[model samples]
Target: MSLKYRDEREPIYTCDRVVHSETIQALEKDMQGVKISMQNRGLNVDVNKLSALIDGVRLDKDKIRDSLYENLHLKGKVNLNSARDIALILSSQLGVKLRKSRTGRYIANRRALTDFNNPVTQEISQYRNLERLLSTLKGLYTATDKKQGKVSCIYTDDCPSGRLYTRDYNLQGIPELGRTVIYADEGCTFILADYDSFELRIISALSHDKYFKDCWAKGLDMHKKAVSDMKGIPYELVTDKERKLGKMLGFGLSYGQEAAGLARNLRTSIHQAEKLIKAYKSNIPEIEAFKQETIEKARSTGFAETYFGRRRFLPDIISPNIVARKKSERQAVNTRIQGTAADIVKFSLVALHKAGFKIDTMLHDGILVTVPEGEVEDSIERIKVIMETELEGLKLIVSCKTGKWWSDCYAKPGRESSPK
Candidate 1:
């Protein structure tokens, strides 16, 4: 708990003991190189296709708006943009169960609607999704350079975690809708490689939880495996609904989700949520210990450090306010886990760019790069090798998919969205 370092040989995130100041500096420099490469080449997008997609989304949005009016039986009577109206309709009129804020008034935000199973709520979510999708992409058409047929974005270190954010068209937050507009050059293709179940693997790596590691070694779907373990059945027998609850259960606890939050996410009773969390923790007991130790360290140091020494200083870790202090505790856990995730991705990008790949943007856990049509097979292997980084005893897995368009992550043209 001492503030002084023991000659900087401490292993904070991973067992490799590589979280040093100089190592972090070198990686940041390499990330700059990759960013420059991305800016120089820009993103190749088909403006015409993007325009058509926007039209389609716009039409859908209009239909959803009308559908909302018809469903609520308040055609042209309520304002879609008004939270007050939506709250009244959902809470007072329809008597739908709604969550309230700390102030204890009925709310109509996304979190309030998370467990609302009404058709109107689903339509509302769809409408909002389309709205958000269009807002991010509609600006791209205007920002693109017509002569170059590409759009460039400025990267910044503005997020809490050290992940890079793209601006001036906000390429960093491209939603699923934006993927359909990606256009490659005539003789080139796009290669996308992402880490598989990256956060869970990182958790197992950090905690060295045996059962979790064993599951990963066998390449079992962790969600289904959890259900299998709980119900004493085979993995294949785990239903989709059970697997989904298992996913919510695992990740929910991993990121410090509480019983109430887990209940809301799973749409189950608080008792059931607690039972699931208890069962999950019984399976992987070490994760809780790791979280406690991580939070204690952050409390002692007043900051959280990622695997590579990226620090997020938390002034509220010791705050007098219980809510802020508890939130800071959660942030302490999340910053290290999620921050390490972002760092590994950047690490992969730095390695691949230095190995002479024409890198594009990073999509959370993956990278999209452009290579010659004939060099895809070779480049995929190279990217995977560089990306499947090694820790002390654990090696990461990288999945690659190539396509003519960014949305297309298929091996063959007619293939569905299945991984190869």
Candidate 2:
């Protein structure tokens, strides 16, 4: 089918004009303020503690290695870091039965090792995790600006998502535990306004999925509602685990996950994963149809567009290579969902700026604003209004919180907080 491609210049030009001028200026100023605040209230890293942890991890690793060497009667020291070495030692030398992993990784790195509760494999995994943590800490330590007494992250506006990216220190890449080291400027509390289930809500609005819309309308937990609908059970009767599984499946659908991938992620049987996917599709047939239509459209047109008409050219969608074509198909669907979410976030940032909210940071689906203690309540309300209003034709439930530090802003239902 010869498909007509929409003039890509229009959407690109529109996005450039909208985001390049005042939006960039506002973001620049926001980033400057954030950098200064971060410097002034420099993040505290306990080097001693991190070093101790590293030492402990090394000791544990050594103990495991010594035990393994003795048990297997190995001739020389084996490199545990080498997946090949580990596989040879376990499979060939030690006569440990190893299953073939689909990922083509060593048996020790496979999911089956965790399922079988292999102590040796678990120890190796623990060692790797600790080594990763140590590397991250080292990076942070080296990146710390001694003159400014803070880690200054360079921001870029080049991301297609219209969201900011941090270079050098990579502030956005910091793990939750790492985030605890950062503190807000004294007397100036942190206020986080996160759009709950932001992209899923956008997808629901876009597809006009009845189950999703009905759940949102009734102020029900969307994940729980999905489980309830899928299982034909009362929402209250759905367990937390079931709700989590439902939530995973719901979000995974947006990423074009197949049954095998879902099964791997949820650590369930392929049959169970298929059943979950079936349930979700049965509950929201429209969304499934929409996704299929999107892939077909992209396959025909060599491109797809987001809700606001942002085009993503997908020539690979029609590629002869199965892997490349499948990837492009997934990207086509994801671009519509994720790209729209990005547009909404960008819109929210611009709106929030015009409304005079001090945007500390713009996370993937959340905005961290700094508000004075007295103005926290008012700021939260205004932020909610701006974010919700900017995304016209959609009803989203935004959650807000106040905290003395960034880590303190644990998301809750309403505007209630114990700002420490």
Candidate 3:
């Protein structure tokens, strides 16, 4: 093994390539406080519950592994952790038509196989998910502070997405099923506040789209409305499945998803994906126009700006190479709402932190707070009010829930409690 260390004694100088913001100085420093609060607050988890969760996931993984072996005769034959081994099995044994890269090597990545219509693919995906869940649960237990029974997660803001990312025991990446064991502290309840359809609202706000704003104000289903308007069908005729397709087109095309990627995810042909994109664009041209405008401005300016005035300089936006330039254009479209959503979440975190709240964790567009049982109602009201404030002229809608555990907040809050 070899070790390389930074030369601490070397002279340091600012290269001056960074984009400095004059208005966001305090905001930048306060974002650090948000991270500090998360680290210091630690995490409250039920050790016994977490152990049970780990056991359940391991059991499920074992069952899936056994099924996969029985189906494929792979018992003691192949390493399940090795994608290449499974990919070989998929290509050679199962006769699945695996995709090849430009170099003619078989692509065995999850993205390549996740949408494949094979039972083995489903089994493998399930096994992998359960395996990861088991590992994450074990990591949480290992990272738990023995004396305090709190899991410590490390967060950093060096994310290209401009959001705080959790490392080590990555709480932000935890699935809903895995979060059930993360409970509120004794005598405390968890308050969850998230922007309703956050990225969609950001796109609408940025584009000054009156239709989406009206939908928000009237409490109408945005997806259903889009389908109704685009397909010339009654809103009531939009089935759950069709509305789901609408959601896919609405969100995906807004973020500049190409037809190939959409087709892969939708398990459909590229032509159908293109038609969906066309339908979405034809009916809701405001968002489409906004996306194009964002890319055009960034292509000319060599940078993208979020709603909160954060700038991400894209040197590739002006590149002479077509591939790099198009990729940069897609990134510019994504940066508009995603970057704004990140900033909005950070702003909410700072506001909540200043209002004397202990932030449990921050997800992409949500914040969790631990409040005393007596203060639950008041906390929810204050948090919703704080989080629902206007952002760049569009009203930010906040949805609040109180729960005993993190996962419970996903459903309607129904946790009963007594005062401490």
TM-score top scorer? 3
The TM-scores, one per candidate, come to 0.86, 0.80, 0.88
Candidates 2 and 3 compared by lDDT, better number: 3
Instruction: Please give the CA lDDT of all the candidate structures.
Output: 0.77, 0.68, 0.77
Q: What is the alpha-carbon lDDT of model 3 when measured against the actual structure? A: 0.77
| Per-residue lDDT of 123 in model 3 | 80
Estimate, for each residue in 138-187, the C-alpha lDDT of model 2 and write its tens digit: 67767765454456566665654345666777777776545555556656
Error of 2 at 160 (Å): 4.9
Candidate 3 C-alpha error for residue 111, in Å: 6.3
Off by over 4 Å in 2: 1-78, 92-94, 97-107, 110-112, 156-164, 390-392, 411-420
lDDT for 399 (candidate 1): 90
- CA RMSD, predictions in order: 5.1, 5.9, 7.4
Tens digit of lDDT per residue, candidate 1, span 1-420?
001112357433422232335555566777887888887878887887778878888999999998777766775567655566777778765797566668976677666665677778777877777887777778887887877778888877676767777888777677766776776678988888988878777777888778878887897888999889987898898999888888888777657899889887766799988888888888888888998999999999898877767778788999999999999999998887888888888888887777888887877788889889999899988887788875536677899888877778633557643221
Taking the candidates one at a time, how many backbone clashes does each contain? 0, 0, 0
